[model samples]
Target: MNTPQQTESIKNLVENIDKGNIVLPEFQRDFVWEIKKTCELFDSIVRDIFIGSIIYGKPTFEITVREIDTRPRKGQGSRRKLKITSFDKGEINQKSQISNFRLILDGQQRATSFYRALKGIDEIWFIAKSEDDLDNEIKTKEYKDRSLEEMLYTFSLQEDEERISIKLSEAYEISKGDMFDEDIKENFFDNLLFVVAMNDAELKDNFRRYKTLCMKLGELFKSELLLSYYLLNMDNEKFALFFERSNSKGIQLNFIDILAAKLYKGFNLRDKIDELESRYPNFKFDREIIVRTISYIVSNGKDIDRNYILSNLNYDHFNLYWDDICKYYNQVLDFLFQEDLAISQNWMPYENMVIPLIIFLRESNQNDFSQMNEWQYEFIKYWYWASILSQRYSSGSNEAILQDSNVLKSIAKGIKITDRVFFTRLKSQIDSYEDIFSYSRKVNVIYKGILNLINYNSMGLTDWNNSSKLSFSKKLEDHHIFPKEYIKQQFKNDEQAISLMDCVANRTLIPKITNIKVGKKKPSRYMTELKASNEKLDSTLKEHLVPTEIVEGLYDEFFNEFIEERAKLIFDLIKKTIIEKEKQIIDQYYLAPRVQGNIKIFATYYSKKLEATLDVDSQKVLLLGESHSVSSAADKAKYTLSGKGDTSTNGWRFWKYIDNNGQERYIDEFRK
Candidate 1:
């Protein structure tokens, strides 16, 4: 076995530019450092604080970095030599002289950040604070209230043909909203007039603060930046292993990142996720779902720990099924939309639910649920609400998934499920309308779920503005029933006041235009504005699920009574909607027991062909005494006729009619 070589070396900003030996690998992500962080990094370096280490692999051949995406070039790969060159903003450049390169396995971000700041790429600077002035600032609390750049002298050394001009500047624009009464720049350079050119005869004193700051900055540049590096021999496999483990302190390496490095494809898994995510812009594709999904099917319902998942996975296993996973998972997304479960992947309360969902859907019946029965739909609904209302996936997530995956697998195989504990537990929960802030501007799972329930149930809000369509998703803003001011007046403690003011029961999504008109008014006062017709206000209130009778004279009732009564009303509304609407969805859309005695049509090269007789009650089509579901029957006919599956054949074209002397058609139509 060949042992890997490891070592450490220090390199300064000048050496990095002059040699250009350190370069990032193609696997490294793009640089995203902002100007503020650049300032902090430069300050840490000048104060001699340790930033961290960089790891490098000494390869046989140096590879150029992918061209950085920026305004100069719009995300295009660069063919340039990719070496850093030394050039002052106003002066000529010097080319690098060294040849041997170190492929950066880690710390590419830190290096790029340093390069940008040192090169003044984004106009970041180091604060040149003297020891005495720094102490004075700390004592006066100047450092506390003001930015480092504002309280102290900051300079950038710009060199021309002859001498370096030490220019004074302020970083107030880049400062994080910290302003000082006194302008540090006013008469800042007064003492430094020709201080560099002054002889001993013309010098006022060499101890002037600005002169000392310039001297410190000039000396600081010559010193090397501290960077600890592990020097590894050229090996792609070893480099990948090190890179995956390198980010243990931060966000650990995702399976996609490791898989990409292992697979070495033209486009990475992230790009594929991006492509899938683009197809459904409203939904966020959780990377863990992708990994867990692949793991679930590959393991055949067995559970795997997060850390060991990548180790067990091989390139062949992923490549073979990745494309199918992408397609089938998209169908899963479409299924979610069809179900109306109040799920937004972006604001999902329990994203863990999606893992088992995709796995079960992908595992069952040719990786789709289009031919599903009524019981399957009911099971899916129960699975969704059970996972949501109960904390089934929140704790012991691995154990829960393992158990749930087994149950779902059994169901998909047409096995009878007698167990009902999970669904029963979810249904038994009496505590609904849990407290969530109305003051929140962000869309959370609870709020989004509430809105989804309303929309799915088709219960439109009663409003003064007349409109045919209820565009609630865009039109609604969260409205507080009890104004914050009223709540504040009711409670002596400020914190207690806000708790009642922002609670979920006190809020509802109403039209934004109405919200603007109502603007901070008490709910009692605005109640009249919500009534559109002569219908009693209480009747309208039931439609919106507002606790009108309780909130009408809410001032009379104590705050606690108000909360309790409104919470009960909200709970009842949710319970009624979910329980009743589910039956409606099943009764109207259930296709398992589809209507029978209809003529079935199939697409052909010349014309239509009758394939099978529909027996909707049995949920099967009979062809030559062979039973098949609607779609499968059509597939069988097309395949037997042409040796191909014409999946595009419209199965819904089945028609029932008395025709001109109508008798049963299907197989008889071909005889005609």
Candidate 2:
């Protein structure tokens, strides 16, 4: 049992790979390193940088293995046939091959990269004989304009000494030959000496200096201490653990990689994911989502975390549920598109939300949302909106998925889910939107949720000029109501003013043509022009939740007020259509008992005094003559607390109230 670290030369490593003694395990991911990375690896090796050690495991049991893909990249060269061979412990022992055979567990990408470059299989590699030669090449007209990538790939194995480069494969072959062979040594050193003599006269005159440099260049390819490795002698179970632990550092192996390796005997998780991707090319299904969904369903929603998926998700469970899950997943996509929640995968507020959605669809045994009854359909819609608006799937999402899946499954079974916390959270999410401001250009889930809501309310965003509804195929732009340049000119150095300029409330989707016409113009100017040109312009602006007052008011003086007014309009629209429409279902299923006489007053003070009455039925705070969720109210309270004018406040934690037992507690306690 050779369980010790070892060293091998680049020459021997490439040879062992060619002889099929060193092979990749069947579970290893494909060589995904780019050509630039391969070039960097070679550059590091030549410069003698520490490139890290490879780790291999010699299993005591049978396992599948494959030959490395030595074929050149497409269009770079022709493809070669790969001969994949399997070996068992018994066969290796019988054939006296135990000393030679090993499965690469770590550094697969690096090892594969070295083999491809050293063997000249993918792209032919080359080395400059001298730095003078490199400098000369860089100064040439042909190479001077080339990028680093072009220079690296363009240098070929030229016979001309003036070119001052040697094929790395040719150099390695000569260097690895017997040093005592005068002809081989002479040929290798002569190539280096010739380039130096032509390029560097001073170094060429100094015989010792030129000879030392030439010998160092020749010895680099055959240096025995260059490539280091560690070998592990272990059984299959230990080998799997060792592989995972070894790769748990930099560029750690993901769950999909570990699961694929563990389930290699009966299934290839990665290949299955690839198949799903190919089958549903229109939908961008993340690989992690697919694996986690499988884990969620197989474990019956007990867990879908990385460790659980790696250890518990097996081939049998995957085989049984995969086809049905795929069917349900397709239906989920159809539902998303049909409901206008997402036109493309990027538009989805949370991609992993698909897990719970799929669970509900599968448990209900429905092909699509069309098969659902009115109550069921409404429940799912509300759930989707609440999930996105609350940013529920933002972090620690697996637990949320499990919780929501159970609630949805119960719904599927005709069980009333009388979860008070769930409805409160839903109502809070709706109320929170009243003061929400999101940077429209950023990757924000809340921003996307608001846009989706607006799209849903409007049927589709309409062109301000033609009044045609925008679709997925049409080019749409989020046009700022007050042009960005105009706002910047007026606000100058005000960060809050600039931020409000880009707020989602101040932006609306219009066709590219409409955007061009509206460019760099004040909203007042554009809206006035639009009103005169288009008869239905007022209705179009209303559809987009844009206030008509912007058409007449001076924006520079009232920009903040305009944003607030428009945000209120957007919030009112979503509340009236989405939230209030589903209020009955929420009231019947998830409402908590209303405390009539014992009304709880929550208060928080920062720079000023603030107070609110908790309306438990509406799940809102009556603060300063306006209704807001605890979160939004907290944000409003924080607006004047700091010179920076930060408004993102976690209201549940900020606002405090006395519980029924006379203990002061945060408003977040109600959620628990």
Candidate 3:
């Protein structure tokens, strides 16, 4: 058993395992050898495909060891497929090679599965028309990525003599429930076509398949699991290191997967996860979210620390509070959908964003959004947008969420939440961003979040008819301000110009109709028409909060200026949007909410050529003699500047507007 052989014949290995020469190390997990997985290995062995190799670690020092669970546990419901469960730990009387016993550091599960098949303890069989079909299947078996009850078959191994040739009828009988009654299994053939032509040669050919496959597969079965062994003889001090190194090269079990196993015994995490997934037929969450949710709840809403997530907590409490976990999770889903947090799953930049909210809900005993105050809603709203613009949860496990999870517990309790902080730490992190182009991969989620904000801002945008608030059902695609087609024509040789088309400043979410109708047209041309036709069109466009830097009679030659100008303007617009969103977010969101009158302010500059003062409230310049938005206000103000105004005079950029305190400030200050 201590022999350091690189390879062993399949027959010899199986026999040795049956005789208890090979044993699993104490560190190994129990045989959770799935039936379908075993069958898959059987199929590959039949094709003589190299499934994989195994590692056996033998200790140089004497160590006590017990025989592995070759036999099934007698009364355990999950172990029915296993044989001879009646063996006892005391019967560990099998001298078991004592210290010289080889421990399967890797491939223990696989080896045991193949061993069962060869010993006729658990017969694994597959149906194929010929050896060629088996060969073709092994080469293309990646499609069976899910559970095992696939093209292979499994039957009871009552006796070794009958193990190789299983009757189709008996295979069906021995299988539990209607397990063999799958649609694929419906084509189970006494003949290849599944059409029974009694006495037909083709039909007779089908009957030979099981026996033929069994005989051929049985020959390779030993060799398949009989893979080359990487044997190491290490002392106890290095055994663990060698075992880890030996298994590290292969697919390692995920920490989360191990966590699921570490939960209370008999806690069917898989079945529970399936139930939760099926609960939302339309929106299924991934397992990590649920696992984190459980961790948050079990810890009483503190933090989803990795160590806690991977350990088994009190089962009594788990059993007691299980329903509450489901309640909090479902409530989380409902809240996200209610808020329209995501246009679709793709728009959801970070699933981790929901962790803090759900943790608060679970800890606060608050299951519904009704418990959320206006301030909380506003805070959450701001947090959501801030998260996107700042990419707050971009990292897998952000400390902010964990930090917020603790703060949320207090806030959820109707405790007057302190404005001591929010996004301040993120400010420097955010400032580090030199620029975010529309084309940046990181900006995609942020852009989508911006789109949602635009559509929802101030009663949303008007539909094509200008009849009603746009419906959420309609998709708003990223629109180029200076159309890419038109821009391409302007800078034909500049590839960077094309790449800059994705700039966040240049991109805005607009109605498909607006996006299409405005296609391939210079902004000054089409927009002038649009500004003239609809009295509310200016406001509608402004509602978008994008930098609308257009004025009449400036274009064809202004393409480069458009990008540079729009880039600055759009950046300013983002700052302004963040300002407004900050108000909705929390107290720390830009020094609490700054409320202003509905009246729009225009930026007015003094005309040095004339000593004239314009009344700001009228939305008019005395020189212009009419009401105007900020842009028009600037036009008149510029005229007063030098008895003339050039195309360079941008009113939006020019005017200094009053804040809530009635103190005048430039639009540029907010951009800071």
Q: Taking the tens digit of each residue's C-alpha lDDT, what string does model 1 give over 315-355?
A: 56666767777766667766665554542344345666666
Which candidate gets the maximum lDDT versus the true structure? 2
lDDT of 3 by residue, 35-84 (tens): 44565565444433445778876554444444455553121231222232
What TM-score would each prediction reach against the true structure? 0.43, 0.48, 0.42
Clash pairs (backbone) in predicted model 2:
none
Instruction: Give the runs in model 3 whose Cα sits over 4 Å from its true position.
Output: 1-274, 302-307, 313-323, 333-342, 396-398, 416-423, 428-439, 442-445, 456-476, 481-486, 494-496, 510-540, 546-672
Full-model lDDT, candidate 2: 0.63
Worst 10-residue lDDT window, candidate 3: 155-164
Off by over 4 Å in 2: 1-253, 427-434, 438-441, 473-477, 493-496, 510-517, 524-535, 549-557, 577-583, 591-672
What TM-score does candidate 3 get on C-alpha atoms?
A: 0.42
Question: How far out, in Å, is residue 5 in model 1?
Answer: 32
Clash count in backbone of candidate 2: 0
Cα displacement (angstroms), candidate 1, residue 10, comes to 39
Q: Which stretches of candidate 1 lie over 4 Å from their true place?
A: 1-256, 366-370, 418-479, 489-498, 509-518, 530-544, 549-559, 573-672
lDDT of 2 by residue, 333-410 (tens): 878877777644556678888878888887787767787787777788778887787666654466578778777876
TM-score ranking from best candidate downward = 2, 1, 3
